[model samples]
Target chain A: MRTVDPAKREAKRLQILAAAARCFARKGFGQTRTADICAEAGMSPGNLFYYFGSKQDIFAAVVEQDGVDTEALFAGLSAAEPWDALTRFFDLVVDLAADADYARLALEISAQAHRDERIAALVAANDRSVRSGLADLVARATGAGRIDPGLDPTTTATWLATLVDGLFNRVAVDAGFAPERERESLHLILARLLRHEAQPES
Target chain B: MRTVDPAKREAKRLQILAAAARCFARKGFGQTRTADICAEAGMSPGNLFYYFGSKQDIFAAVVEQDGVDTEALFAGLSAAEPWDALTRFFDLVVDLAADADYARLALEISAQAHRDERIAALVAANDRSVRSGLADLVARATGAGRIDPGLDPTTTATWLATLVDGLFNRVAVDAGFAPERERESLHLILARLLRHEAQPES
Candidate 1:
């Protein structure tokens, strides 16, 4: 009749999610079943069911894991100069794409988001949250007259988000593509795109 | 024995690819079996084997079917005005994303491309072709004094390609996301990024 500690319960849930992510990454969502998740978690089926109702629920939880708190990642970005803040965000994405398993899981979730409404909504919300944070940073930069004032913050934010996603796909598929090379290219592109200068002297 | 007509054989291969694309889109590559593809294509397993060696080969053939014909798609793009050509390219992508099944198939291929090297190489090659085509267009545009003369065409091409991929993800995931709306937003963002003069104050 002892009550379980809330912190202890939450910790267990996180442990389950971590294991589930590994299983999902190794074998895609369609191929990974609840039993596989249980085996990966080192727990019995009953114990795993006690935490998540079904395989899809476990998948939802795994996709929602706080792998990268995009908001928190960019929280202090505004303090830096606009160009610096933008490049920092790009570098963070490039670094994250280096983890092959994480990248695989991301690609799987993206594919699922197309068919599953709930998952799609969840991913869209996360995408908006990240874009809003970047938009705020862009707005601040524009206010400070660092970026072209004529640029729409939301549009620029979306453009930047797209750039990150594309880079992730490139990194995930191409083994030889170096993140350092992409980062340098991105810095130059962003500088030329945002600055009003007509011609950047090579 | 009479020889089969070459045109008829080629058409039959295309039919098989189309059916495989549908099956892969509906049931992912892993879940799909050779029998399933044969059934979908209304052919016997032996007949399917005559055309494709295995289920994986069928999947690869299906993916290869969607190969980006850069030469065909961008034939006159370099000769067009810079901003005009870029806008047309973006518009064409938006149009393509409107075909839900095609977009779904593309997403599925991208997801599976990571696990299969042949598929990965195929996807990468398509990416490179598109990037190269965009680079040529960007170079033409810059040389014609459309874009910033000093901007690197390759980098600009990469960013442009990234934007298209990101937009495709958005269209695929968001049920309420209209292709027109997404395309409009993209146009605005690209115009700003390319430093094209904004539509005169109205």
Candidate 2:
């Protein structure tokens, strides 16, 4: 029996997914070839195919990876104070936006979701994960009296989700937009929306 | 020599553009054909081609029309009280979001803007028009002491732009999301972000 190291195999898979993401972000699903992903990963086509069967397959993996990442993010956030966790969530997005490739990939995934059902479903699942995570935090915070008890958790979660989406959309549309610069204002908006307290920060 | 009536020509051009918007909204730019636009407009390919050399041409025209329409919207809002003008802008977006086709087309155009430079330029222009219009109103509002004097018009304008982008995104991701249902919350967010006075409405 041939021995395949599971850890090594998983690492290689992640390596390929990261490289594929960069290429997809730069070019787009329809325009990028499987060969292109191979070149990005510095692997032979056979090795790449050993893991991902086609370009579409690789694309699906990338989206699935995003869902996994979101799950992991909320996993970490789940343990923290709910209001702080919610604020920290925006901070994490600001960090993500600092990497233009990551930001652009988000836009690409959204664009591709409009065209492909599988991708759309994956995107929706990822979105649901985010909204539900935020909603959970909101419910916790509301119960703890850390924020406005009058705010509906589901609705508040939806708006927070919108701000996150809009943050990426801002990067996509405006070249002059710097997400890092907007962090202060983002925090202010959240404070007012969820905390009902004015954050007097410039 | 055949004489063409200028008013008739202009009206026909608008008719074609409206039909093309529907097709692009329904099928996206790449999937929609010039023939589709012509069929939707109830015109022959020759007639469509006479007005637009290609699908790309009509797409550009639709984007250009959006800019023109925005200019006309701001032209009317220019005379209103600045804070009210800003609030009405959100009202206008809520109305547009009520039409699924119109809202979907906005997302489609944004997605297409990612790949095509010509489309990107047009979309950028449209964003600039929106941001600048909002900025002008913010400036007037601040000067009139209707808003926080500390607020920078352009920055406030950008955040408002994000909200608008987020609104369209919410529609795209959540099937249960009704823009009409969101109108009150949108107003609440705006009031909190801009009005400086805490809006008692949840």
Candidate 3:
């Protein structure tokens, strides 16, 4: 019967999500339990249920949160120069791929997406959101003469998304692939792929 | 007490692996039962057990077969011109990615690799084999003046492998990404990435 503070409620929600993310990354969705999530979050089962109904619900919330984060990132980049924004986005990918938990969580979610229809829908929606964001940036860059005029923005964006997906895949499977060390090579590849005029360093 | 024909026995073992691949692709590793594999292979449980100890064993054999197939492919390409061999390799990739079953099976295997250490070891060994094969091709191309001298063969090969992994990922996630249609774009990207003098068409 007591009134819950809105800000505190949101903070508690995020805390639960962060803990669930770690549990999902370490044990995978099939193996992770709600009790484990509650344990990780240092919350009671009753408090955890106040935020999410079931393990499946919590998993769905995790995917939905990723979409929200990605949208927020694009919104922040919207005010920057188009080419710089695109490079900044790739740099962030390098950083995320460098994080072991984030990369493993990505793989876990993707693997679950194959078997769960709900997860697949969420993943596909997230993928579309990412591609559309890239397409908008590509269009802006092309209009500004920073990218090749001949390349279709949508197609270019899709290929760029493929590169991002590939980057994560490399981190998951290859032990020797260091995302930080490959940052320069990634930029060089991007410049070449987009046919940018100046050298990647310049 | 009866003597078994070794060639026939080997052929039957391959038959079971092929059937298991289909079952694993369709239902994923966790959901696929040994009984389902038997039904798919048109064999009794006893016959299936004669060749494999469990679903895990059959899955491992499928991964092992991929390594064998890859080694055979590189052996075939070794006699060709370096650039020509590389292009042929990419062409075959396009063909394989176009197959829904193969692409789905790849995802399944990769997903399983995350939870299973034995599978992880096999996948890692196979990945190393693939990268080494690519490095050899890149080295030959560099020595023949077909590739830029500034590019290190191993690094270049690693990125090229990344593209392959990315291609398969696109197939798994993007329903709109048609591998056959993207063949030309892939070639162009490769040309630009490798700094090949001639256009992809030439």
Interface RMSD of 2: 5.5
Q: What is the TM-score of chain A alone in each candidate?
A: 0.87, 0.95, 0.95
What are the per-model C-alpha RMSD values against the true structure?
Answer: 4.3, 3.3, 3.4
Model 1: per-residue lDDT, tens digit, A70-182? Answer: 65777768578866787788788878777777777777888888768878777887788777877887887777766777668887787677676666666655556666667
Which model, 1 or 2, shows the larger TM-score? 2
**What is the per-residue lDDT of model 3 for residues A1-202, given as tens digits with 9 covering 90 to 100?**
8688999999999999999999988888878999999999999999999989999999999999999999999999999999899999999999999998898888777767877889888988899999999999999999888887877899888889988888887887788999999988887777777755522221
How does candidate 3 fare on TM-score?
0.93
For every prediction, compared with the true complex, DockQ reads 0.32, 0.38, 0.39
Report the C-alpha lDDT of model 2 over B91-201, residue by residue, as the tens digit.
Answer: 999889778888778887776777789988998998999999999999898888777676678988999899898888777777678988888887777766776564322
After superposition, candidate 3 runs with Cα above 4 Å error? A198-202, B198-202
Kindly report the fnat of each predicted structure, to 2 decimals.
Answer: 0.31, 0.34, 0.33
Which pairs clash in model 1? Answer: none
What's the CA error at residue A92 for candidate 3, in Å? 0.7
Best-matching candidate per TM-score: 3
